[model samples]
Target: MDEFLKWYFSHNPVAAASLGAEGYDHTLGDLTASGWQTREREQVQWLDRLSAAEAPSLDDAIDRDLVLSQLRGSIALASWPEWRRDPAVYLSTIFAAMYTPFQRRLKPEAELVESALSRLAEVPGVLAACRANLDPDLAAPLLVTRGLGQARTGRNLLTRTIPAMVEDAELRARLAEAAEPAARAFDDLVAFLEGFECGGTWRMGEKLYSTLLREREMLGYGAAELHAKGQAAWSELDARMRAVAVGVNGGDDWRAAMESLMDDHPPTLADMRAEYEAETRRAREFVRERDLVTFADGEECEVLPSAEYTRPVLAVAHYLAPPPLSASRRGIFFVPYTPDDFTPEQVRQRLRTNSRAQMPSIAVHEAYPGHHWHLSYMAGNPRTVRKVFRTPYFTEGWALYVEKLLHEQGYFDTPATELAHLDCRIFRAARIVVDTALHCEDMTVEEAETFMSTKASLSPGTAQGEVSRYCAWPTQAPSYLTGAIEIDRIRESFQGTPKEFHDRIAGSGGLPLGLAEQVALA
Candidate 1:
C-alpha cells in the first residue's frame, strides 16, 4: 500500500501537493500521452497486487478497497479521450500547480518562493504538452470556450494575483521576474485555443456515466435510477420550497419570494464579505452551544473575497479545504461578489445571487459544520489514504446534509432564512436532474441552463455558470444529494445521538457513500 501510494502521488503530483505531500510542490506531473499510457499500465499492476494482498484489520480492508476502487475507476475512464477532448485538464493543472503553494503557504517563505519559481519555469513545457496532446477537431466547443476563459484567468493569476499576494519585496520581485514567461505561455495557449475548431460533444453518455456512478462512486444504482431519484427529490423539494415561500411572503409564488430575498443583499462586495464572516462566526457559535460535533484543536477558517481568476467559473461562492498534512488547517471560504469589470446589470445579478438571506445558509454550508468543519475532521485523520482520498459524494453530501441539520437545530432566525436554506437544497436536487440529463439524456447545454434558471430559480448568469461546471465535471453534481440521502439513511439506523453520529461519520474522512455507510453504521 505504501509503495503504491508513493507511485500514485509521484504521478499525480498536483493532487499530492494539495494533500500536503512533500517532494511534489515544485513539479507538475507528466502531461504527455506516453506518460498517461504508462500510468494506466502501471495502475493495472497495482490493482492486481492490491487484490492479491490480505487486509489485516477492518481499517486495512477499507483502505485496500478504497485504493482498489480508485484504481478501477481510473482504468475505466482512461479510454474516455479527455486528454484529446478537454483542454481544461491541462489548464486546471497549471492553475492548481501555481495556486496551491500560494494558497496553502504551509512552507517557509523562501521555500515557497523557490517552489513557485520552479513551477512557473515548467509552465511553458506543460502548455506545450497540452498543445501536442489535445486534438482541436475533437474538442468540445463549450469546453473550448471555457478553457479559453480559464487560460486568461491563469495569465491574470501569474501576472497579477500572485504578485499582489506577496508582501516581501525580494520575493515579489523574484515572482514578477519569473512570472513573465509563464504569463506568455498562457497567452500562447489562449491564441492556440482561439484559432482551433471545436465540434465535439461534452456528454459522457449513459455507458460511461453509469461507470462513473457504479464503478467510480461505488453507488448501488445506475444513471436511470439516479435520474429518477433526482426527479422525485426535485418535486418534493419544490413543493416544500413553495410552502416555505408562502409563509415568508404570504404567497405560494416561490420565485417571487426568492427574487424578493435577493433584493435584500449587502450594498457592496466588502459588506457582503463582512456579512459572511459574521454569519460564519454565528453558525460556529451555535454549533458549539448545541454540541453538534467535536471541533478539532487549532482548526481555523477565513472568509474572503474570491480571487479574480476564480470568479469566472466559481459563480457565487466556494470553500477551499486546508491541506490535511500541513501544520495549518486554515480553510478559506471565498465569496464571489461582482468584479469591477462587470456591467451594472451583471453586478446586480451577481449580488442577487449572494443576498443577505442567502448568506446564512452559504455560511452554514461552506463554513461552520459543513465543508470547513467536516474537512477539519478529515484533516485530522491519522490514516494517509483517508486524508488524501476524497469523494465529492461524501464531502459535498456532508456539506448539504449539515444545512438541514442546522435548520433542525433552529439556526435560521426567520422564515426568509428558512426559505433560503430550502432554496439551496432544491438547487442541489435540481443539480441531480440537470447533471443526469445533460450527460445521460438528450439535454443540451442551453437546455440545462434553462432548467437551472426556471426550475431551480437561479439567476441566468448563475445558471449558465452551473451548467458549464456540470458539463466539465460529470458525476460530481449529483454527489451532493446522493451522499446526503445515504448519510440520512445511515442516521436513521444509527444507535446514537446526532452529535455522536456526526462526529463518527465526519471523523472517518471523505469516504465513498457505500464505505461511509459501513463505517458510520459499524
Candidate 2:
C-alpha cells in the first residue's frame, strides 16, 4: 500500500512536492497523452493489487477502503474523454505545478528560485505535449475560455508578478530570460483555442455524473434525491436568513440585510488583510478557550493575497494546505484582492464578497477549525494511506461541519454575523442544486449562473466563476453540503459533546463520511 501510494505521487511530481514529498522539488510531471496513458494503466493495476490486499485490523481495513475508493474514482475519472479534450486539465496542471511550491514557500528563497526556474524552462515542452493530447472536437467551449483566461494569467505571472517578488539579481536575470518563451507558448495556446468556432460542451451527462457520485463521492443517493436534499436545505437556510434579518433590521428582507452588511467592507486591500488576520487570531483563541477540539502541535498558517495566475478560477478566498511531507506546518489562505486594472464596480464587487460581517465565519472556515485545523490533525497521523488519498467530501465537509459546530457553541454573536454564516450555508445548498442540474439535467452554464446569483445571492461575477468551476469539476461543488450533511447525520447518532464528536471524525485522518460513521460505531 505504501509503495502504491508512493508510485501515485511519483507519477505526478508536482503533486508530490505539494504534499511535502522530497526529491521531486526540481522537476515537473510529464503532461503528454502518453504520460497520461501511462498513469491510467498504472492506476488500474494498483487498484487491482489494492483490492486484493488483506487488512487484518480495523484501522488497516479502513485504510484499505480509503485507498480502494480513491483508486477506483481516479481510474473512472481518467476513463473520461476529457483527458484528450480538455485544455484546462493540461494547462491548469502546469499552472498549479508552478503556483503550489511558490505559494507554500517550503524551501528557502534561493532553492525555491532554482526549482521554479527549472519548472519554468519546461513550460514550452509541457505546452507542446498538451497540444498533442487535445482533440478540438471534444474540447468543451467553457473549458477553452477558462484555459485562455488562465493562459493569459499564467503569462502575466511569469513575466510580471513572479519576478517582482524575487530579490536575487542572478535569479531575476534568469527569470527575465525565461519569461518570453513561456509567454509565447501561452499566446500560442490562446490563439489556437480562440479559432474554435463554437464553445466546447461542458456537460458530462447523467451516466458520468451518477458514476462520479457513486464511485468518487460514495454517495448513497442519486441526482434527483440530492437535488431534493439541496432544495430542502436551501429552503431551511433561506428561512433562517430571513428570520435573522428581521431580528437585526426590523424586516425580513435578506437581500437588504445583506446590502447593509456589505456596507462594512474594508476600503483597501491592506485593511482586508488586517481584518482577516485579526479574525483569524480571534477564532484560534476561541477554539482554545472553549476546548472545541485538540489542535496539532505547532499548527499554524499564513494569510496572503492570491497568486496572479489563480485569480481567474479562485473564489473570494481559498486555503492551500501545507505539503504533507514538508517541514513547514503552515498552510496558506489566499484572499483575492481587487486587481489594479479592475473597474470601479468590479472593485466594489470584490470588497462586498469579503465584507466585514462575513469575515468571522470565513476566518473560522479557512483557518482555526476549518482547513488549517483539519490539516494539522492529518499531519499528526503517520498513516501514509491517510496522508495520500484526500476526498473533498472529507476536507470541505469537515470545514462546513466545524462552522456549524462553532455557531452552536455561540461563536457568532451579532445578527449580521449569524446571517453571514447562514448565507454561506445557502451558497453551498445552491451549489448542490446547480452542480447536479448542470451536469445531469443539461442546465446551461448561463442558467446555472443565474441560479447562483439570484438564489445564492452571489454577485454576477462570482456566480459566473462558480458556474464555470462546476462545469469543469462535476460533483465537487456539491461535496461541501453532501459531506457536512452526512457528518451531521452521524453526529446525531453520537450521544456526546461536540468536541467528542469532532475528535472521533477528525482523529481518523479525514476519512470518507460513510467509513467514518462505520468506524465510530465499531
Candidate 3:
C-alpha cells in the first residue's frame, strides 16, 4: 500500500505537496501530454501490483479496493478529452499549487515562498503544453469561455495574492519577475482559444456519461435510472418548497418567495463573513449539545473568503478539507464574498447568493456535519489510502444526509429557514436533472442554464456558472443528492442512534455508498 501510494503522490508533485506529502514542496506537476501518458502507464503498472497483493482484514480489503478504483479513475480521466480541451484542469492546478501551501501553513513562510516561486516559474511550460494538447474541434464553447475567465483570474492570483503573502524582499522580487511570463502564458491560451469558432456544444452524450458513473464513480445505476430519480426528487422538493412559500406569503409561487427572501441579505461583506462564522460556531454547539456527531480531538474549521480564482466555480461556499497527511487539522470553509471590483449588479447577485435565510444550510453543508466535519474525522485516521481515496458520494452524500438530518432535528429557525433548506434540496434536485440532461440528454448549455435558473431559482449568471461546471465534469454534479439518497435508505433501516450511524459511516473514511452501506449494516 505504501509503495503504490508513494508512486501515486510522486507522479503529481504539486498534488503531493498540497496533500502534505513531505519533500515535494519545490516541484510543480507535469501537465504535458506525454506527462499524462506516463502517469497513466504508471497507474496501470501499480494497479497490477496492488491486485496481486493480499488483504488480511476488511479494512485492508477496502484499502486495496481504493487503490484499484483510484488507478482506474485516473486512467479513465486521462482518456477523456476534457483534460486537453478544458483549460481549467491546468490553470486551476497552477493557481491551487501556489495558494494551497500557504492556506495549509504546511511549511514556514520562507520555505513556502521558495516552493511557490518554483511552481510559478513552471507555469509557462505547463500552459504551452495545454496549448499544444487542446483539439479545437473537440473544444466546448462554454468551457472555453469559463476557461478564459479562470485564466484571467490566474494572472491576478500570481500578480496580487501570491506576492502579498511573501514578506521576503528577494522572493517577492522573484515573484514579480515571474508574474508577467505567467500572465502572458494565460493570454496566449486565451488568444489560441479565441481563434476557434466556439459554436460547439458541451454534452458528453449518454454512453460516456453512463460509463463514467458505472466505472469511475462505482455507481450501480445507469443515466436513465438516475435521471428518473432526479425527476422524482425535483417533484417532491418542489412541492415542499411551494408549501413553505404558501405559508410565508399566502402564495404558491415559491420562486417569488425565494427571490424575496434572497433580498434579505447582509448589508456588507464583513457582515456576511461574520454571519458565516457565527453559523459555524452555532453548528458546533448544536452538534455538541445534541450529540448529533463526533469529531476528533483538537479538530476545528475556519470560515474564510474563497480565493479569487476559486470564486467562480465555488460561487456560494466551498469547504477546503485539510490534506489527509497534513499536520494542520483545520479545514477552511470558503464563503465566496463579492470582490471589491464587482459591479453593482454583480454585488446584488452575490448578496442574493448569501442571503440570511439560506446561509445556515450552506454553513451546515460546508462546515459542521458536512465537509469540514467529515474531513476532520478522516484526517485523524492513520491510513494513507483512506485519506487519498475518498468517494464524492460518501463525502457529499454524508453532507447532504446531514442537511436532512438537521431538518429532522428541527434545526431550522423559521419558516424562511425551512424554505431555505428546501430550496437547497431543490438546487441539488435540479443538479440531477440538468447535470444528466446537459451531459446525457439533448440539453444545450443555454437550455440547461435557463432550466436551472427557472427551476432552481438561481440568477442567470449563477445558473450559467453552475451549468458550466457540470459541462466540464460529467456525473459528479448528481452526487450530492444521489449519495444522500443512498445514505437515507440505509439510515431508515438501521437500529442505531444518529450519532452511531454517522460515526460508523465517517469511520469508514469516505467509502462508496454501496461499500459504506454494507459496512454500516453489517
Candidate 4:
C-alpha cells in the first residue's frame, strides 16, 4: 500500500516536483486531453473500486497511523475537482509547490524548462475539457477555474529566474529561448482569461467548495467550524497585538526595537543578506537551545537572497531543498534579495519585511518548525504514504502552533520577540477573516489588502499581493490558523498525558490529521 501510494503521488506532477521524485519529471507530455482523460477515468474508476470494495475498516487494521490517513485521503483526492482542468482546484499545482526547480540546481534546469514548455501546449486542451466535461450552467460560488487553466499553467514558467538555477552558458542560451515561449504561453492564457473567463466564469459552486472543506477538514478542520474559529482567533490576536503596541518614540517601541535589530532596516542589499544570515544563525541557536523539532546534527542552513526574479512571489523567506537528496543535509533559507542598486527602498522593505521581529517568528512557521522540519521529518519517515501525502493544514498548523510554542516555552521572551510573536498572531488572525472575506464574503481585493496593511501593519504592496494570493487560492489562508487551532485542540485534548506528543504516535508523525487523532486523542 505504501509503495502504491508513492506511485500514485509520484505520478501527480505537483507532488513529484515538490517532493523531488525523480521518475515523474516530465509533466508536459502528460497534461494532454487524452492524457488527462485517461488519468481522470482511471481515478474515477479507482475511487469507485475503493468505495465499493472496502468498508473503510482498514483504519482499524492499518498499524501505521499515517498510512491510515493516506488511505483515507487517497479516496478524497481521487474525486478531486470533478474536472481535470479546473484551474481553481488545480492551481495549487502552480503556485504553492514547484519552486525549487526554478530557483535552485536541485535538478537539471533544462529538463525543467523542457517539461514546462511541453505543458504549455496542454493547457488549452485541459481548459477545453473543463468546458466540455463539466456542467457549464453550474454556478454558485467561486469559479470552478475553467478557461484559465492555460494561464494558470503559464504562471509557473518563470523564465526570469532561470539564470539563478543554472549558470552554464549553453543552458543559459537554451533558457533564453525557453523563457519566451513559456512566458508567451502563460501570457496568452492570461489574455484569454481577461477576454473570456473573468466575467463569465464557470463556478465549481458552493457544493464543491463544501466538498473541498470536507476533504481538507477531514485532514485539517471543517469549513464553517474553521470560519468561526478564524474569526475568534483574529479577535484574540488583535487584542494581543494592541497590548504590545507600545508607541515608538525612537528606540522605545517594540517596532523600533525590531527596526534597530534589522540594521536600521538595511539601506543596502549586502546589509540585508547580512541580516538574513544573522537571523538564520539566530534560528539555529534557538532550535539548538530548545531541541525544538529534530534538527540533524550536521544540518546547517544559510540565509541567502532570493533570486531577484522569484522574490516577489516567494514567502519573504523560503527554504531551498537540499540539492537532489544527495548533495547535502542542509537547506538554505532563501531570503528575498533585491539589488540595492536596482530598487533600494523596495529591497530594504523586502529584506526587512520577513526577518523583522514578527518575521523570524514566521521562520518558525516556514523554516524550522514549519515546512523544512516537517518535510525533512516526513520525508525520512519509514511510511511510504508519508512521503507522498501532504496535508497542508496539518503541516502548516503544526508550524503555526510552534510559533506560539516558542513563546510558551520561553523561546521568544524578549519584549521585542514577544511583540514579533504578536505581529505574527495579528497577521494570521487577519488571515482567518481575510480568507473567508475574499472567498465567501462581499469584500473586494482592495478591501482585503487594506485590512491587512492597516490592521496587520503590512505594506500596501505586500497587502495587495497577499490578497491576490488569498483570492487565487481558496480556503488556504484559514488553514494556517485552522490547523494551528486544531493542533492546539489536539494538544489540550491530551494535555496531561504521560506520553510525549512524538512518542504516542511514535514515528507516525509524517502522516496528517487523521493519524494525529488516533495517537493524540488516545
Top TM-score: which candidate number? Answer: 1
Which is the leading candidate under lDDT?
1
The deviation in Å at residue 450 for candidate 2 is 1.8
Q: Which parts of model 4 are misplaced by more than 4 Å? A: 2-11, 51-99, 102-160, 167-197, 201-207, 219-221, 246-264, 307-315, 320-328, 337-352, 493-510
Clashing pairs in 4: 144-203, 144-204, 217-221
* lDDT to native, each model: 0.87, 0.81, 0.81, 0.55
lDDT of 4: 0.55
Q: Candidate 1 lDDT, tens digit per residue, 1-522?
A: 789889999999988988888888888889899998899899999999999999998888888888888888888888777888888888888887787677767877788889889888989989988889887667788888888877877777897888777779889899988999989998999999898787877888899898878977899898999999999998998888888888878999888999999998887778889999999999999999999999988999999888676677678688889888776789999888665577888877888888889889999989999999999877888778988788999999999999989998898879899998888888988899999999986798889999999887699988999999999888999999889888999999999999999998899989888888888887
Error of model 1, residue 363, in angstroms: 0.7
Q: Rank the candidates by TM-score, best first.
A: 1, 2, 3, 4
> How well does candidate 3 score on lDDT at residue 38?
83
TM-score of 1: 0.98
Model 3 off-target regions past 4 Å? Answer: 196-201, 339-341
Query: Per-residue lDDT tens digits of candidate 2, residues 1-522?
Result: 778767877888877877777888777787777888888898888888878899998889899888888877787777576776677777777777776766666667788788878888888888887677777667777787887777767677787777776777778777767777887898887787778544446777777777767776677867778888999999999988889999768999887888778888999777888889889999999999999888877778788887777777766788888766655678888787755567888877888888999899899989989989888767767676777677888889988888898898899888989999898889999999999899886577789998998887578988888898998888889888888889888888987887887776776777777788876667
* Model 1 weakest 10-residue run by lDDT: 307-316
Q: Supply every candidate's count of residue pairs whose N, Cα or C atoms clash at under 3 angstroms.
A: 0, 6, 0, 3
True lDDT of residue 165, candidate 2? 67
lDDT of 3 by residue, 1-522 (tens): 888777877877777776777888776777788888787788888878888999998778878877677677766666565666777878878887888877777577778877777777888998888788776677677787777777767767888788877777887777877787887887787787677554555677787778767766678887988999999999998888888898767898999998999999988777888899999998878878899888777777988888888765656688888887877778899888655567889877887878988888988899988999889887877778788778887788888888888888889968889999998988999999889988776687789999999998698878877887888878888999999999999888888898998888787788877677766888
Using TM-score as the yardstick, the better of models 3 and 4 is: 3
- The TM-scores, one per candidate, come to 0.98, 0.96, 0.95, 0.75
lDDT of 3 at 364: 88
Q: Per-residue lDDT tens digits of candidate 4, residues 456-491? A: 656676676677567555666766766776677777
